[model samples]
Target: MLILHRRVQLLQMTLVDCTREKFSKYEQLLNDAGQKPEFWDVVVITARDDSQKSIFDYQISLKKQRHEVPSFVKYIVISDPPGVKVGSGGSTLHCLEYLANNFGQHSLSQWKVLIIHAGGFSQRFPSQSVLGKVFLTLPCSKYPIQMLEALLMMYISIPGKMNYGVFIAASDVIFLFNEKGNWDFRVPGFVAIAHPASLKLAKNHGVFILEDMISPWGKYRSDPSSPAMVATPKCFLHKQTAEVLKHKDSYLPTVPI
Candidate 1:
């Protein structure tokens, strides 16, 4: 079953239209920057828990329902004090090391990975729409697992030639998962009411932050069709950015496979 499952294609060809339509805005940004508009295949969600409030319950819930999520979507948790140990060691930093060690063995030349922290950042943008908004933060989008793919797309897309990419803030968090979730992996066609983490694909990951620098003003475009697209921010780039962020090359200690 393990071998057979690995060979199983994680995404469906039929989702192309939905994916493209959802990511049209980012595609436009990429076009403006002359970059390819492609979505990422893997996502790493960085989560943490305080002594007063614990995100571990959520983490445990994810492990119990891991198989239920699509194989393409990978969930991770990084705790401040470090929570339960599923498989990888403790803390968000350790989790990232373990992932770097294990996934390093595989070829990521054709893959892209998005790393997002549980607590998103806040930015102000001029628009008739929402402003002074906190984007991609967990409180805004409580569905961490569901937000994995789409959230990563909101930041940037991974280039096909590279195996690892990151979109971390200066104080961003990186995470990992030791054991897979317990849920069954499957994709559904459409739903009026469903969880965000349950979707097969949301948008393209490659075309994020097409602008070279933070523009003073521009329209913050959000897909009217997608109610879950809280990470939408237009015409402005974060003060900090990276063209091709990698794990082994990053500040974190290199975890060799």
Candidate 2:
């Protein structure tokens, strides 16, 4: 699920305006200096407790080779201390504490944050085990770009309007959408993007049960100018069996085979 915070109270600026100003300043700097400035205020990459050094080494290699690694952006690697295996959630908490202690809460509150959870050794794709999955080269890209670069490109437009709130994302999956399309991020509370998938596919991922079974795709296709349809989720089930989904009253058929 993709969740976006509406605003940050400390900044006292609308997310959209804050985001725009950030990009505007970056663009001006890039044009003047002929090099990219720090695009993100703080980029925290969570790593496994033992793999912290390896991740740091990988970044150094990328910079030495002059790849697409954005060295300009301030990146901090946070891992579980000592014997504790805090997992993703714990690592994030450790990051917050580190920031508060080092940068102070007041200063940290004003900065835009991007947290990437990419700590696991890619056992399924063992070739990426050393460098991790985030550095895996994509075959579909026109030019050579690693998974990290591709993820950054996908979110390049989102930060401009965002306030001091954090943007958290996983490194494994990529969501494709129209870059120029109108996307509303001003909605209050957590906003998750949903995509249509077959029942078999849904079993392996999270499925949202909406209030109604009516399909909104018909209206969306018929009138492109209309506002995007929003649904009220009644419940969300993760990795549920096909039989369980079929029995749910609000469960609607997904994409057909």
Candidate 3:
């Protein structure tokens, strides 16, 4: 088992008030720890053309901090070809495919993939952002398509132990914490429901499971505050789950996701 000192981090919700100062501090926090690349890795992507020079510089500063950031904790950026509508979800899918194909699933040790959009900032974008949410909202997505796809992929990918923390950030910047006395990014429940609980169910069909764990045939919906999202099998997914992901264009897009 792998373990590291957990940092209390902050999760950004919007681009508004997105001054360099606000997040710049977090970079220092990650760097002070002298993070080795093998300790953590992140794959961040952009759907539209945005000035990521700032974000890049921010990460580079942190990555270079031998005292805090690990020389081994490598980060990369990917782009979808122009004209191809690779939204948030698609971007994430594409990143995963690219990572798996080039580096193989085992490339990064304990990896984390953040599928954020250039235009879209975060969940708080529409409500609090200075500009409109540029994230491509899928026709079917009351939520954003990229966001849904990201969550879906994360839902499936996380069951197994990952190299980098495998995640799909629809349009949010990742920050390493110093000691804010807040959220712990190490725990999976921040985004996923715990597995092997009693509510576990096995059903059938190409069902769009409404709960945390996928049910075969049933469609479930839940209250925002309720917990029993879905029942999950203990341990990780077997090779069978990987076979399921290989179908159609399940992997990340070479051009986009």
Candidate 4:
């Protein structure tokens, strides 16, 4: 377990170094546009009912350290009702309802929400089962930081990319991207980040088949600062076999949002 954790930290550090320049530029762009780069009005973390106390304890720890958490961001933990087995999708809906009830309908349209689904037991990683996966300690930095803090840092630049809307993500995955290109986040509906992956890896994940066979990274070579491509998915295949993926020309596996 220690070796696995160290490997994760090394990977995370390498990716952060690779993307540092681009992320800095992106944040500067946001600042130039008169926006607070990493500010999320509300961050809602979903947890199992039994994990509520520990999650709150984590929040309190953050408060004790004055500089740990952002002042503009509000953290809310919505625990699943006891004995209720609401899955991720259901928990998301409950979170939305909770927001509407507490913050009121009018305020909903004004605030940018980041909903993190961290409710499940970490069966595969039994070491984290007690504290929940999101609260798992990370060894990337000198100051102690948990998986939740690292996840927030990974997505810090995203709030400035779009208008008022919810950014939903799972607790386990960390996406690293070079933000050199412009991303059109003002699209009408839902937008997701898709990462290139091998067919073997895509087999157990959601795969996006594009309408055209055009390369999304084609412009990156010619113009590294070109706007990133966003396309309406031609089709979506969930947990499909490699044979099925081959037929669909699947190359990019979407990061589960």
Candidate that would win on lDDT: 4
Tens-digit lDDT string for candidate 1 (16-99):
444444355443533453443454555454443342124433543554465322333444444334445332123335545646
TM per model? Answer: 0.30, 0.71, 0.36, 0.78
Report backbone clashes per prediction: 18, 4, 31, 0
> Roughly what TM-score does model 3 have, to 2 decimal places?
0.36
> Which regions of candidate 1 deviate over 4 angstroms?
1-21, 24-38, 50-71, 80-95, 102-111, 119-150, 153-163, 169-257
lDDT of each: 0.33, 0.63, 0.38, 0.70
CA lDDT of 109 in candidate 2? 58
Per-residue lDDT of candidate 2, residues 72-133 (tens digit): 56777666666757776677778778888988987555887777777776779888776777
Task: Tell me the tens digit of each residue's lDDT in model 4 across 1-257.
Answer: 68656655665665667456444553353345454554689988888884564665576466436455554567888887677688988888889999999989876678889998888888899887666778777776646767776677777767778778888998888777644456756676778888556777889999888776455544333333333566667888999988888778765334211
- lDDT, model 4, position 212: 61
- What C-alpha RMSD separates each model from the true structure? 19.9, 9.5, 15.2, 7.2
Residue runs of model 3 more than 4 Å from their true location after superposition: 1-39, 50-72, 108-110, 119-165, 172-257
Q: What local lDDT does model 2 show for residue 162?
A: 56
Best candidate, TM-score-wise? 4
- How many Å off is the CA of 2 in candidate 2? 33
Between prediction 1 and prediction 3, the one with superior lDDT is: 3
Model 2 CA lDDT for position 195: 56
List candidate 2 stretches off by more than 4 Å.
Answer: 1-39, 57-61, 64-67, 81-84, 107-109, 212-217, 220-230, 254-257
| Candidate 2 steric clashes | 4
The predicted structure with the larger lDDT, 3 or 4, is 4
